[model samples]
Target: MAKKKTTQDPALAQNRKARFNYAIEDTLEAGVVLTGTEIKSVRAGQITIGDGFVTINGGQAILTNVHIAPYENGNQFNVDPLRNRVLLLHKKQIVRLAVEAKEAGVTIVPLKVYLKHGFAKVLLGIGRGKKQYDKRQSIKKRDQERDLNRRFKN
Candidate 1:
């Protein structure tokens, strides 16, 4: 009797530029409330979070600018791709995020979207926009690391 092994699902979509443009101080995982067609599109890897941001309003966390492409076979069931979607989070967590987001230069950015236990989840980052000079420093550090790795390989 061998034990079964469960495979982890990779992110359906990611915001690659979030780290480059923002200095993330904290991160949170949140469940997404998606309709049937939207979920199908997400599971098919037809989702994008490049420009997504999270905002709290009326005690609810909303995901905006994330796009879940319409399912090919969904037809009428497919809803608007850019519609604001609710994020499932505890009231206390929402309150904390909202408070943190109100700080000057601080905002919530969507980092990644993945599926776990048949539910879609988003990884959100609490970050501040990086200054132009800071971005240059990040690039310099990355280039130095790449050069070091190349030197070691050859």
Candidate 2:
């Protein structure tokens, strides 16, 4: 008998600017609570996490500002595109993340959203905002690396 092959869905959305704007320290995978229409929209690759952020309230984590466009056929079942969604995380993890986020200039940001085993998951990053000089340094470093790679490839 031959084994069957399975292909996974690609990432629905990603916050590429997160790394450029912040220095990421830690990361965690989390599940998101979504309505049927929202999930459908997400599966259709109509989500954006560019300005999304995570916050802990009452020992639970919530995702805000992540936009999931209304489903075309959802009609009245479609909810707000920018509504807050709950993030499912362990209690201990929630406490730890909350504490880390409360530290000076630290925050929890959504790095990306993807499907895992047919369920939606979020990649959360604990990061600190980078200063202007830091951003400049990173840009310089990236340029130098690119130049080195080009020289070696030629």
Instruction: Name the lDDT value of residue 73 in candidate 2.
Output: 98
Q: Clashing residue pairs, candidate 2?
A: none
| Cα lDDT of model 2 by residue, 1-154, tens digit | 9977655457788899999999999999999999999999999999999999999999899999999999999999999999999999999999999899889999899998999888999999999999999999999999999999999999
How does residue 129 of candidate 2 score in lDDT? 98
| TM-score, every prediction | 0.96, 0.94
- The list of candidate 1 runs beyond 4 A from truth reads 1-7
lDDT of each: 0.95, 0.94
Model 2 misplaced stretches (Cα beyond 4 Å): 1-8
**Which has the greatest TM-score?**
1
- Residue 62 CA displacement from its true place in model 2, Å: 0.4
Look at candidate 2 and tell me the lDDT of residue 12.
Answer: 84
Model 1: per-residue lDDT, tens digit, 1-154? 9978665488889898999999999999999999999999999999989989999989999999988899999988999999999999999999999999999999899999999989999999999999999999999999999999999999
